[model samples]
Target: MNYPLIVFRGLNLLVVLLCASLALGAGKPLTDFSLEELMAMEVTTQAKTPQRLSQTPAAVFVITADDIRRSGAVTIPDVLRMVPGMHVAHIDGNKWAVSARGFNGRFANKLLVLIDGRSVYTPTFSGVYWDIQDTLMEDIERIEVIRGPGGSLWGANAVNGIVNIITKSARDTQGGLATARAGNLERGSGALRYGGKTGDNFYWRGFVKYFDRTRHHGLPGETAEGDWDSLRGGFRSDWYPAAGEQFTLQGEAHQTRAGALRTEPLFTAPFARLNDEPTETDGGFLLARRSWETDDSTRYRLQAYVDHFQRRRNLLDEDERRTTLDLDFQHEFAPNALLDITWGLGYRVSRDAIDSGQVITYRPSKKTDHLLSAFAQAELPLVAERLTLYAGAKAEHFESVGLEVQPSLRLLWTPSTRHSLWLSASRAVRTPSRTEEDALIVLSVRPFDPPLPLTSAGNTNIATEKVTAFELGYRGLLNDRVSLDLATFFNFYDDLRNFEGVPAAFVLPPPLPPLDALFTTRNSETKARSHGLEAALSWQAHERLRLMGAYSYILLHVEPRLGEEDFDFSEEKTPRHQASLRAWLDLPHNLELNTWLRYVDALERGPVPSYLELDTKLAWAVRDNLSFALVGRNLLDSRHQEFPVESFLKNSVTEVRRQIFAEAIWKF
Candidate 1:
């Protein structure tokens, strides 16, 4: 299969079916719900209060549970691809590069991800390891995605966007459920969940899930060496002691093992060779939260969590162990009718122990770091429902860097009940990570006469990366059945991380070998800027039919100072243009059909050809509690490459092949 031919054929068939249905049928559709029902959806990720989607000031997107189920998505990252401004790419079978607007790479550092308020980003690399980010898809309530800077609320690394995964409460899932799926690429997967009442006022739920994934196709259609598997289990408990107070506790554990083929440099003869290595990872976390409301309309919440993470990998000859503890509190009050205020405080501490080898080594074998933050925000209704202003700032102290403050100002104007306009300006920062501050990596070991070694050393004086962003947005409901959201933003970045080489040669004792100079981390004097626009539209054409479309455009420019090396790959790695369209149809007899079409522009660095992707899912409910589905993904092409070749550690590129899967779901 290839582009245009297969894509046009599929689209033609879909158009004919849709037109015939609309011209022949005369009943209600699945989208019979009113537009007010859609706007009334509440999201809490934006601020302290759960506000309607239309009232938020930021460029926010909500992925509902129905969207997840209908899309036939197996993972969180896969589901995120539906968002308008997000950039999600598969690097390998077990790795993903996900960001927003621009700045995408294997280690995308500017995006922050959280699960039930627990940060999943690694401080060592300032990125997320997607393989272990697993959850029961059916248990997810919704995913809130903010496409612009959220540093004033979420702190560091939230420079680009924020993704918050919120799960259903135990009280809402008081039943038993099971799912089993199998496919050529997915291999096999299964999950079991059970929820019930633990006491008169306490509800609890537990779940266990496991999956195995096969390898991808190489450049020449050969099977690549990328296979992975994992096992995970978790539980949650919710207690309601009174009408105005609630308590919740949750914990999860996961173990994952994976393998990949890599070509690594050697110190002796045969400088490089292809080899396969096994990677092992495991982690666990426990969290607790309490919330209460007073008679005076004041709300308070306290949350705490502890996490333990360990990764043993042969690819880098590295073993890492980390433990973290976090505590946070928030208070919201309405002192007056026109003023709403929120204050929050947080503290986090992490300790890491790394076992290094010839590949990379940390200067300090063990280290501990602390981060403390305080933030407050106020919302004032300038003219009641017509105009409003929001102002907030956060001050944070890190062990490596002193006090840093992030601030934001936003204004919202409601011209009518059906339309809203919002504008915002914000400042955010990305703090230095462990890799940039205290790591030594051996790029290559040459087996020459003197056994010379090339190594890169981390710099302790590396400065933080900062960004100032301005955004504008418009949201409107054209009629009872149509709605649209549009947003634009410009971001200016300074003090970005760059590499500078220092020429030096040092001779060691007779027992050791000599080393040559290599590049080190530094702050660039130049600056970078990016501007983009995102638009999304939805239409409920019929009672049983709905259509959604999204488009995004981004332009990035970087200026390197005089006499400095212009070496930034972010602009080339991210796509400049992307678009997607989806359709959801509810047929007779408990049958549902969903289709998605997406396009991504070519990468500047890879010079990879642009591609179109098509996906479809057909599902039937045999009974009220039992269902089955058949899903097809990447149907437009037999295979396509989504990421460029990575030669740093010799991680090659693999093509994603066409996949079909069958799933069975049961609920009681």
Candidate 2:
């Protein structure tokens, strides 16, 4: 009985069997689809136009591509591993510290990652360093995970979530595809892609990749273990000389080398100061969109972009460059009384360069930054088949918060066909980075004048990081195999830019010195609360087997107002308990079988004593472009440790113990 009284009596028997199937009218909520398949699965980035997920109201989560190839995972943060208030970890091997809903670790500055819509963050650590975040996971095609506060439509770091990553056009990838893999720990890999057609309004695609990874051992004898190698290339094209107008071209380039291991002790003292270091980064973007459709509902779009970014690393002596020019436009009015409308305007400019080791910075003497924004959204349509009301607002002007207004209000209700309800109220922000506007501390540990040197410097007038979010959501399916997506949030913080510790009382006339108490970056007054519950299930029982699962339970509190330092271990590193079981077996000569079983839970730090991880997958297909695979990770080897300020360990490392891999694919 308990268990929240069986979840409030199973949500009151699912709202009384969906109101007795809408009093038997039986056709509602896309009754069995149609309206052109519900406008091809209604979705307009959560309220720009058409919306459906039983009638949208944020808290969305979709990662299709067959759930990223059935979660065997090949990046994209391992397919965002079953979303649901995501917080995927894995801090090494190209680093990763994704977050959503709560302050998560490793520079997870309020989340807001996009691709294809371009904007990979990292304008000097804004977020996302997911180890050179590679793309081309089969050219994506889905991955829109929004979890609370999109700031009236993506503004100011989206405040905790927004990971769009849409792609898959080259006329829908018209040709070649290939992949090969090997492992003992992901030791080798390969990929190639090809697409055609370049006349009658161009369309093209090209991709090439190379990879090497084998370096992660560290534990005995303590030798550096940071091996990595990478090479990447990219291309995308599209041109529609007529018909609604569209033009897009994209580019990417990469180079990486690492063996990195050095933590100042003496220029040369062999034990673990390895190096083979060479680092590089490249970027390119060009966008132009023009849309005009005076009928069938109306449309308008005008977008522009130009980008060039570069990064050079030498362990720590930065050389960064960024040049950006972006502009935006969008307009869709009419669909009248549903208030269907969307608005837009945007601008951006950036430039950065820094070079000075041992932590040092020289204020951004104005590389450049300018962003003016405007946004509007409406959807109000209540009672024409249930209820819905969405509102929006966005007004930004920053060269330093000259103006700011991010608003949101949403509410959706469906009184039939499998009830659903949602509500939201938001105001999100999280700006000021360069580690809180240029953090510089050049040299320390040179007290006697040998190992450490000067020290202390940082403060570029830091300020900009605010939030006020509130949301509530619920989804339903309760039958024909179950389904549920629930949400809850309450985040209220201000300024909040950590790193503070100031104490100094000096008098150095005795030898050659004085006070030395410093730890800059400040802006406090914080708060947090991210309630949760996300459930997913699909039990076809038999009929080719199926039993999917996903569970999330979050309850972060973070509120220590008197003498800080309480960000709560982010509640034991994600995965409150994730379960999985999938099958599609149809074994009979021609062949076709797929399998998966996963369970991840148990994790801790602070008294450190918790662990558990297991994964599995198997596949065999002889059609639909062939397939063959086998992959296993941890498989219960269990040992765990993924960042706890592990900083090149003295212990608290090793997250994978047993791994097996193999893969092959082809498509034409």
Candidate 3:
């Protein structure tokens, strides 16, 4: 393929379109807000409270609804690529490896994810199943991404970052919407949604969505087997029960059948071979929340949710069912004119039942775990509105890890309304997952005559992984038409996860071969330190054109404590440099054009070579509530690899291919 020529031609076409649009000046601009208005936007994920972006003492980025629609991203993971410090890579057609800063993998455990205040991080594997996390993209209000530790408020597993997906209120989406899309890679997809009002105070909405994705190219001539389809339906309702009180109820259910190619070792003659398998998953959740404000300027909220899921995987011969129940309460008050305080309490219980497989087994097939936590933060104004100080901590108790405490201190200095500077230091931890403490896995087997097997045994005495991070940031409006955000961080890690070699043992059966080597999962003497810089710039080039650019550089170093071996692969997993540029232009005849160009550095371990790609979208609005769009993704190349196959799962490596799709949306 003539990759360079294709990219050149694409860019030329984009330029030609821009020229025509400028000459005609016909379409409405996507964003009419000024840089100051953008800087003054309020975000909640940073502190669990509303704070202006320019004054918040954290590294935060928000993706608005307009950004989502213009990015031509079909999935949440693809939309996240715009964040400066975030690393998003596709493992296959149905799987992705996403992380922040460093330590990227199939199951990146350090980053925490939430959907409408409900956590989606699974306790079974300490990671998310990206294939099943879905919703109607049009209904998403915004995605708030915190690029630093949120442990002081959100609790464990939030060591690196937090991603919160917030949806729009039912009242904002009153009407009926229908959408359909088709393409070579996407296959087919459609959505139907309706919103109505029962009374003056009550609003409700319901929606159903379905999608089928085709498989991607495999390594060279091999056929990659990952293809998936999903169906989901959900509803949300909001009621203003009284003058000072409000209530919200929402629920969703989903079913998915995903295909994959797995390689596993057998106890018999042929050590390992390929296995074509399909994974079946079904899940649902219901959540309710209530909020009230008192005349004395005090606020209170209560929320609860129940979630359940079941999965069947043939490659591991495992069938699993899990359920979780969580409850939380929060209060906010200003004791005095100079000081404000926020506090919360939470409880969660999770239970899982697993049927063991030939390759993997859990000591206790059925187990239950509980977590209790409380957190409080106080904000003190030092120099009126110019300087402020914030301190907070969270204490959590669990059966396995006893008690864990995370604390943070932050200071923000606003020199002017247009610029602010901030610094923070925090501590966070990651608790052990069920698989790390109870499962025994057959990592691989040597093709010897006797068939020597290498196994990984779980250790019950594993400790929590911990990190202490320091960060400094600046957010400012460079001018009336431009804005800039910069952040730098240094992190130190301790008690990191590692595998230690154990003595080999023989099997009881006489004909069976002995275990060649064994390793146990544990918190070894491995330590690490990382530093990075991230910057983002936004320019409203004209009333009809907007441009955004981002760049990030990171360096991670790992070493053994004293004379111990590292025995970890954290250093080579993350890329060293990443950059992206995006442009949105309004054209004549109600036309819109958006383009994104991105580059990712290679991973040292897989030697996955660096690659650059482009995605473009062109849309035409026929009326106020009807539109059509043509989207092209990965136009620079036919296919390219983004990540290597996971070592533990041994899934087949696949490449991302060029895709073109057309979409039509109608609202009545």
Top-scoring candidate (TM-score): 1
Candidate 2 backbone collisions, by pair: 94-131, 445-452, 446-452, 446-453
Question: Estimated TM-score per prediction?
Answer: 0.96, 0.31, 0.95
lDDT of 3 by residue, 333-400 (tens): 99988888999999999999998776777888899999999999999999988999999999999999
Per-residue lDDT of candidate 1, residues 570-634 (tens digit): 57777899989898888887888899888988987666678899889999989989999999998
lDDT of the candidates, in the order given: 0.84, 0.62, 0.87
Model 3 segments beyond 4 Å from truth? 1-28, 506-519, 560-569
CA-only RMSD, every prediction: 2.2, 24.8, 2.6
Error of 3 at 629 (Å): 0.2
| Cα misplacement distance, residue 630 of candidate 2 (Å) | 29
lDDT of 2 by residue, 465-577 (tens): 77787777777666655556677776666666544555332221212234342333444454545566665554433333334556666666555344555332245554455
Q: Given candidate 2, what's the lDDT at residue 545?
A: 37
